[model samples]
Target chain A: MAVLDRDTINAVREGFTRHRLSWIDTLPFLFAALMYFFAARYLPLGTQVMIQVAFALSLDLALGYGGIDSLGHVAFFGMGAYAAGLYALYVSSEPLSGLAVAACIGALTGLVTGPLVLRARGLTVVMLTLAIATMLHELANTSAMKPITGGADGLFGFKIAPVFGMFSFDLYGRTAYWYSLGVVAFVFIICKLVVNSPFGLAVRGMRDNPVRMRMLGVNVTARLVTLYCVSGALAAMAGGLSAQVTKLVGLDSLAFLVSGNALVMLILGGAGRLYGAIVGATVFVALSDRAAAIDPFNWLFAVGGVLILAVRFAPQGIVGLIADWSQRLGWVRR
Target chain B: MAAPALAIEGISKNFGGLRVSRDISLSLPVGARHALIGPNGAGKTTLVNLISGLLQPSSGRIALDGVDITNLAPERRVGLGLARTFQISSLFPSLTVAENVGLAFEARFGLDRRLWGRVRSRPEIVEGTAALLQSLGLLELARKRVADLPYGQRRLVEIALVLALEPKTLLLDEPAAGLAVSDRGALLDLLLRLPEALTILVIEHDMSLVFRLAQRITVLVEGQVMTEGSVADIRADPRVRDVYLGTRSHG
Candidate 1:
C-alpha cells in the first residue's frame, strides 16, 4: 500500500468531522465528562478518580480495535502512574512535564514488550499479558527501586504542580478533576481519529484475518507495534491523571486484579465498539461503588458473578446487547 | 518470443516422509491456458500453493517474467504482477463486492495507505473495480457484502478480485469448483476470453472444463507428473486413461 497523501488524510479526517456530534458518537465523552465534572463537585477528596476511565479506554483500544486480549494493560497504567509520580517528586512538579514523562515511559515500555506479547495469538496473548502484569507488580513490590518507587510503601506525597504555569492544582479536587476530564476528552478525540483512519481499518482487518492483511502487503507487526505504542501513551496519560488526582501511586495498579478488572470493563462495554469502553467503565465503577456501600468484602464476588453472567449471556457486552435488541426492534440497521 | 510468463524448474516439496510434489517443472508462456489435473492426492493444490509462494519448494526455482521469484513473499509476488484465486471462495466477506475488488486495485496502484478517504469514493478504484465486476457479471451484486452473496456470486467476485490486480500471470485453483454446470461454462468462457498477453494456469478436476479452456494439459498423479500434452493427446494416453478415466468406473 502506498503512503497516505494529503487528500486522503483530509478525506478521512473529514469523514470523522461529519460524525463528530452525532448522538451516539458524542454520548460517551459527554456522559463521562459530565459525570467527572459532577463527581469533582460532589465526591469526597482523595478518590482514585481517573483510573476507571483510563483503564476502560486503554482496554478498549487493545481488545476492541487491536484484537489483542491483553491482561497486562494495567502494567502500562501503573508504570505511567509511577513514572508521573517520580517526575513530580524528583524531576519537576509541573503536571504537564510529569504527564509527558509518563507518556514517553509508557510508550517505550509498550514498544519494547508489544512484539513479544503480540507474536502469540488468542489465549497465548492473554496469558502472556497476564504474566507481564504479574511480573511488573512483583518488581514494584521489590526493594530494588525502593527510594524512587517507595517499594512496599509505594510513592506518596508527590505534589502535582500547575498546568503549564497557568492553572494551579487546588486541594479541593476541582483542578485535578477538570484537568483529567480535559485530558480524557483530548485522548478520546485522538483515539477517534486514529481508529477511523486507514490505520484503523488495517487494525480491524488484522483482527478479522492477519494472514489476509499480510497477503495484501500490510506490515502486520508494524501496525501492531504502532497501536501498542499509541495505547501505551494514552494509558500512561490516564495514569498520570490518576496520580495527580489521588496524590499517590501504588503497586496495586499493576496487579492482576486491576488488569482483570480492565478486561472485564472492556468486554462488559462491548469489545469492538468505542463507546462500549465508557459504558463498561461507568457501569463497572458505579456497580462497585454501590456494592461496596452495601458490603465491601462481598462486592468482589458479586461483581465477578455478574461479569461471568455478562460474558455468558451478553458476550458482546452491554453495547452489543443493546445493538442486538435495537436490530430486533428495527430501530437501526447496518 | 520471450521467457515464459512463469517457469517452474524441477520444484519438489516433501512433507516429512510424504512426497507432496516431486520434480514438478512446467513453463507457461504468454496467453497460454495451461491446466493441471490430478486425482484426490495428486498435489494439484500443493503445486499451486508452491507457485504462489504460500509454500516453499524443497528444490526448484520459480521465475516470473524472467525474474527469479522463488523466495519472494506472496504479496511481493503479487506486486510483481502474479495473482491467484483460491479453490474455495476466499474473499473479504465483510466488505462490499466493490470494496473487495477495490482492495486489489488499491494494492496494484499502491494506494493502501490512503486510509481516510472512502475507498469506493476514489474514481479510479471505483471505475476499475466496477468494470471488472461488470465483466465478471457481478455488477448487480457490487453493493452487497461478500458474506451476503450466493456461492456462485462470491466465486465471481473472487474472479473479479484477481482481474482487478491486472496481473501478467493468473493462477486459478478450481475456479469452476462447486459451480452449477451453466456457471462452470460461463467461468470457462471468461477464462477463454482473457487477453492473449496474460498467461493463465488453472487447476481443475472437471475434465470437460479443463479440455474446453486449456491450450495444453499436464496430468499429475500421486505427487508426480503422470503425463502432459494437448487435450487430445492426454485423452488418448493409456497411462492417463488407466490412472484417471479408466479407474473411475469402479467408483
Candidate 2:
C-alpha cells in the first residue's frame, strides 16, 4: 500500500509535466522486464495477462473516455485473432506483419460499423454491438467457414517468424512472452498519449455534454466514430498477440463471455483511469485462474462476490479508490 | 450594403401536431443587441433552438451574413461563427475550468483534431485560457474542476467558453438565471464589456437586465411576436404590460 501511495504521487506529478515518462508510468514495463528475467516460469501466464490488460485498455478508451458503452467489443478481438491466424496461414508467416493485418481488419470493421452502431445510445448500442459480434461468431462456426476458421476445432498449424531473426519462439514460450510485453508497452504509451491530447479531452467533453461540444464546433459523432475505430484496432492487436503467442485462434475469442469478462475486469479495476486496466486484468485473471483450479463451479460465486464488493466499496475501482485516499491524505490533488 | 449578422424569416416549430413556435421572423444587423422576452412557455427557448439549429423551423429561411443557413447542422452553424450558451449551464463537470476553456480555444483554433500533443503544453491554448480565466475573475479557480465551482462561477465559465470560440453572433439563453442579485452585476459587467462589433441576442426574463443590455426588444406571446420596439417603447406598450408583464414588477 505504501508503495502504491508513492507511485500515485509520482503519477500525478508526471501528469502535470506532460509528455515525459515517470517511474510510475514506466513501472509496468520495468516490472514485466524484471519478471521475464527472474520469474521465467510464469512467463506464459504473464503474457496472457498482458494481452488481457491491453484488451481492457481498449475498452477503457471507448466506454470510459468516449462514453461508448459496448457489449460486443470482443468482435474486434475475435476478428483480429482470425485475421492474424489466416494471415500466417495464407499470406505470411511473419508475426509482426500478421499483427498489422489484424489491426487494420479490426479498424476497418469499426470504421464500417461505428457510424451505424454509434448513432444509438444506451441499451440499443449494446444490442447492436452484441448482434454484430454474434453474427461473426455464427459465421465462424458455420460449415462454409469450417475450412478457413476450423469451426469448433479452432484454427492452428501456423508458424510465426522469430523476433528480429534472433529470438525463436521456443516450446517454453519465452520469446512469445517478451514479444507480448513489448506490444503491451507500446500500446500503453500510445493510449497514454492519446488520452492526454486535446483530441482526447474533446472526447471526454462529448461524453459529458455532446450538445455543448457540438456547439463548440466539434463533430461529436464523427469524433466518437473515429475513437471507436481506434479502440477497435487496439483491441484487435491484443487479440492478435494472443493468437500469435498461443499459436491458435478460437471461436471463444468472439463470444459474449469474452466481452463480459473484459468488462468485469475493467469495472473491477475501475474504469477511466488507464492503469486501472492493468490492475483489474492482472487481479481478475490471476484470481480466476487460481479459483478455477481450486473449484470450477464455486469460482463463479467467488468472482461474483469480488465484483459485488468491488462495485459497492471501491466503485472507482482499486486505482480510483487509492487516488481518492491519496487526495484525502494530501498526497495528490486529483 | 453589408449583410445583417443574422436574419430569420417565417420561422415556426411544431411538436407532434402541437405548435410551439408560430411564424416568427426577426433581423439583427451587425453589432445589434437584441433581446427576446416573453412569459413562461412562450417558446422563447424553441426559437433560440431554431436559430442555433438545434431545432428545424417547420418553415422558414435563416441566414448568416446573407448565406441561407436554415439547412445547416448545429456544428456547421457554429463553424459559421454562431454560438450559444445553455440556460442550464451545460459544462464538462469533471474537467478543470482551464481545461474547459482550453477546449474552446482549441476548437476555435481548429486544433481539436490534434491527437498527439499534450493540451497543456500548447502555449497558445494555455495563455489564451489563462487570459480568459483571469478576465472572468476565475483565474484562481482555473485549476478547479467545474463541479467544484459555485453556480454563478459555473455560468461565467460557460460564457467564457463561448467567448473563447471568438464567435460573431452569440445567443445567450437566460445567462443570468440562477445567479444571485449581487452576482448579476458581475454578469452585467461581463456582458457590457464585450466588443461592440460582436452581434449578440439574449433571451432573458429580467426586465432591467434586458433594458440595460438590449438595443431592441422583441416580445412574444403564444409563440408569435407581440411587439418589437426599443426599451422605452416596450415599457409604454399597453399589450406588453397586460399580457407579458402583467403584475410582475421588473427587476
Candidate 3:
C-alpha cells in the first residue's frame, strides 16, 4: 500500500546505462568469430552471411519488434552502398568514414520519410516503403543520375582504403569478413539495448494494442519513426560494409529482390527475436549460395520449397523451435 | 473546489446522420466512484469514447482538473491523468505481466527513449512493477505471459495494467465482462481497495457488481441520460425500474 502511493513514485528513472552480460547475446558473436578462424576458405560466403545478418537485423527491428513491415528496406542498404561508394571515390576512400557517411544518409532518409510513411497503417505503410525504395532504385537507374550513381552499370572505379589503414581487403575477403563481423556484433548490441529497453516494450505494447498505448500517453507514430531511423542507420551500415568490401555498388544493391530476400530471411529465421536475423541470415545465405551454384536461375524453387516447409513446421522460426524444445524439456518455464 | 476530477458539458457526437451521443453532460467530483450503465446500443461506450478523446464531440467541452481538454489528443489526455480499459481485454499478449504493468512506469518516468538499458535490470522499473503487482495481489502472475493467462486472470491483468499508470480518473468499459462469479468477487475487492485519490467510471452490464462498486449511477438509454442519482436513489427509483432496472436483474 505504501509503495503504490504517488509520493513513492520516482519521477526520474535511471540505471539504464549498464549493459548486462547474457550468454545468449554472446553466442552468435562467438560463432561468428570462430567461423572467421575455422572457416577461412569460406570467408567470402561467411562475409556475405554476416552482411545479410546485419541487414536482416535492421529489418527485424522495424518489422519484428517495431511491427513496421517494410518490403523495401533495401532503400537504406542501397543508399548506404551508394553513399559509401561515392564517399570512397570522391572523399578519401577511407572505409570507416565512408561507412559512417552512408549510415548518416540512411538515418536521414528514415528521418525524412518516417513521419510521412509511418502515417499510413498496415499494408499502405508497406506499399509506401516499397514505393519509396522503388523510386530511389529508378532514380539511380536513370541516365541523368549515372554520373553520380553510375546508373545501370553500377558504381565502381573506387578503391576502399585498407580497413583502419592496415588490413587490406585482399582477394580472400579476409578484411571484409572481420569488418562485417564487427558490424553484425555492433548492430546486434544496438538492437539488444533497444528491444530490452522501456522504449522497446512501449513499441511492443503499441504493436499489440495501440489504443492502450495511446491511453498510456505514448506517441506511437513518433516512437516508430525513431525506430525506423535507427533501423535505417544500421541497415545502411550493412550496405556500406558491402561497398567497402566489394568496392562495387551495383543496381542489385538497391533492387527489390534484395528487400524481398531480407524479408524472407527474417520470416524464415523468425521475427521479433534478436537471434532470428542471425539464424535466418546464416541459413538463407548458405542455402542460396549452394542452390545458386547448382541452378543459378531456377534456384528460387529450392528456396521456395524450404520457405513453405518453414512456414508450416516452424512458423515461429528456427530459434522459436529451439525455444519450444528447451521449454518442453523443462530447461525454461513457460 | 479544486475542480472536478472530470467534467463533460453538453457534449454531443454524430456519425454521418447517426447521433451516437446527444447533448450528454456528466461530471465527477474528486474521488468519485461512478458507473455508466445502459442496455446494448445505448451509446454508453460512445460517451466514453468522446470523453477519452477517441471520438470528438460535435459540440461541448471536456475538462480535467479545470483545464479544457476537449481538443487534446487521446494520448495527451493520458498525460493529464486520464486512463481507460476496453471491454475486450487489450493487452500485450506476448509480453510478461510485469512487462505489461511496467509499461506505464516506463512511459511516465520518461524511460521510453532510453535505448541502452534492459527493462528488467532497472531497479525503478523492477521495484515499481513488483509494488504494483503486490498491491493488486497479482505478484504471483508477474512473470507469466499475458497470452497464457486465463480469461478471468487476463481481465484482472488488464485492470492492473491500467492502474499502473496511476491515473486520477479511470474509464473502464465492462471491467467485469465474461468473468466468472469468483473472478468478479476478486475484481470487486481489488477495486474497493484502490486509493481514494483515484476516480473511477465503470460501464457495466453486471448489475450486482455495479450496485456494490459504484456510489453514483448514471443510466443511459438511446444516447440520453435516462437517470442519474445516488446508488440507493436510482435503485429505489420507479422510473429507473420502468426504463432499465426491470429487465436488468441482480444476482
Candidate 4:
C-alpha cells in the first residue's frame, strides 16, 4: 500500500507537469477525491462507494479494452474478499497482507480460468463466466470450507491495521474512506497508463478486427490472458478493500447478481472509456442506495427500467451521452 | 542464383470441393511490375491472399528472395519485405490519414510500443508518412479522419499505407477496384512513378490500367494460369480473347 501510494502520487505529479492535462482526463479523479473528502468529513457511509467504483473500473477494462464481456467478474471479487477474510482470521489482521493474498488468489484463479472462458466469444463467453461465478458462489456456501469461509454465514470479525501505521480506522470513517480512495486512485492511474500504451492499442485493434490483429503477429490469446489476470487482480483488490473497511465478507459478494450489477454499471457509464466505469459506479451505487432507502424491492425495478431505457436510447452510456451533447453544443471536440 | 522476389510454385487452394487456386506457379523478379488479370471469381484475389500469407496454399511453396516463407504469418511476411494493399480500403477509420500511414511505418520500424511519447510528433515517422501521402496525392487529407475521405481518397490512403512500409515486394489486390475513371487513371500514374526497386504484383480487373502498367500479364481462368505474356501478346492471344476479353465485348 505504501509503495502504491508513492508510485501513484509520483506518476500524478509527473503527468501534471509533463502534459497539458485535459479537464476530461482529470475530472473523475477530482470528483472522486472531493466526494471522498466530503463524505469522510460529513457522512458515515464507510468505503462501500469506493470499493464499488474500483470493481466497476476493473470490469470496464475487461469488457471495454480487452473486449471480453464477462458476467462472472464477481467471482474474482468474492474470491478476493473470502481470501482476505480467511487470511485475516488465520494469519494477520494487517490490511496490506490481506490485500496481497486476495489479489494473488484472484489473479491465479483468473489465469487458470481465463483461457477457457476467453476461447469462446460473444454470449458464450458471458454464459461461461456466469456459470463459473455461480459455481464459486455455491462452493463458498459449502460446509467443508465453512470453518474459514463461514459458509452461509460468511466470514466475519475481520480487522484492519492503521493506514501506514499512522491513522487508525475508527467510527468516524475517515481512515477507511481515505485508504480506499488512495487505493482506487492508484489502480485507476495504472489502468489508464496501460490502456493508453501500444499494448492497449493492440487490444483495441483486436476489438475492431481480431483477424487483422492476428495477422499483425499479435499473440491474441496470450494478450487476452494477461488482461484477464490483471482485471482479476484489480477486482480482487476492490474486494479486499471492501472486506477491510466492512470487517466482514459474504458469499453474496461472488454471486451473479453482484456481477450483473457491475456490468450494468459499466454499460450505463460507457464501455471502452475508463471514466465511464467511475461514472457508472457512482450513479448506480448512489441511486441504488438512495432508492433502496425509500423502497428496497421496487427500487431494483426502477433501476432495471432505467437500464433498459439506457440500452435502447443512450447505448454509449452517460459519458458518451455527455460527450455527444458537448460536441453538438461546440463546447468540446475530440 | 538469386531467386525471384516472390516465387509461387504449384500453389493450390480449395474451398470445400471447389478449387479457388489450382497449382498456380509464378515468379516475380526483382523490380518487375507483374499484373494478374482475370474475370470475377477467376481466383485473382485468392492468389494474392496466398502470396500475402493471409491464407495458406494447400500445396507447393512460396519463397521470398530464395528463403521459404510458405508458413510465415502475414506480419512476418511484411517484415520480410512483403507489403500489400487490400481491395477494400482498410485504413483505421477513426485515425487521420497521416496517423493511418504512420501506423504502417511504426509497424515496419518496430516502434509499436513507444507509448507515453508523442508518436505523431516523431520527426522521422511523421516525415516518412507525409512523404508517402504526398506521393499518393493524399497530403491534403493527412490530418483528416479516413472515414471522412471520399472513396477514391481512401483508396489512395490505403496505397500510401502499403508504400509507407518501405517494402521490397508489394502486392496490390485490385488497387483501383472502386474508383472514378479519372481517379483510376491518377492511381495508375502514381503506380508507374513508384521507385523501381519495389517489385509489384497487381491484380486488376481494369484492362486499360493493366495494359498501361504491367510489364507482363498473367491471365488466370478457373483457378489456373491460362496464359502469361506481355500486354501486346495477351491482347492478341486468341485464347485470352475467347475466355476473358470476349465476355466484355457486349459491354
Each candidate's DockQ: 0.28, 0.48, 0.44, 0.22
Interface RMSD of each: 7.9, 9.6, 5.8, 12.5
TM-score for each predicted model, relative to the true structure: 0.88, 0.95, 0.94, 0.87
RMSD of model 3 against the true structure: 3.3
Order by lDDT, highest first: 2, 3, 4, 1
Each model's lDDT comes to 0.77, 0.87, 0.86, 0.78
- Here, model 3's chain A TM-score works out at 0.93
Give the Å error, residue B17, model 3. Answer: 0.7
lDDT of 4 by residue, A100-175 (tens): 8998988998999998998678999989999998988988888887776888888887677787778899887878
Measured on C-alpha atoms, candidate 4 has an lDDT of 0.78
Query: What would the per-residue lDDT of candidate 3 be over residues B57-139, giving only the tens digit for each residue?
Result: 99989999899999999989998999898888988887778778888788777788777767766777877777777777777
Tens digits of per-residue lDDT for model 1 on A8-36? 43332222211133567666556656765
lDDT of 1 by residue, B16-103 (tens): 9999999998998888889998788899999989988889999999999999999988778888888888888877776666666666
Residue A75 Cα positional deviation in candidate 3, in Å, after optimal superposition: 1.0
Residue pairs with clashing backbones, model 3: none
Give the CA lDDT, 0 to 100, for residue B245 in model 4.
Answer: 83
> How do the candidates rank by TM-score, highest first?
2, 3, 1, 4
Give the alpha carbon lDDT tens digit for every residue of A1-334 in model 2: 1122433333222323243467788787888889888989888889889999999999999998888989999999999999999998888888888889999999998999899898788799899999999999999999999999999989899998887878889988888888998888877887888888888888888888888898999888788888998899999999999899998998998899989998999899988878899999988988887888899788887788899999999999988898899999999655
Q: Taking the tens digit of each residue's C-alpha lDDT, what string does model 3 give over A187-267? A: 888887787777887878877877778778888888889999999999999999898888899999999998999998987
| Count of backbone collisions within predicted model 2 | 0
lDDT, model 2, position A90: 86
Worst 10 residues of 2 chain A by lDDT: A1-10
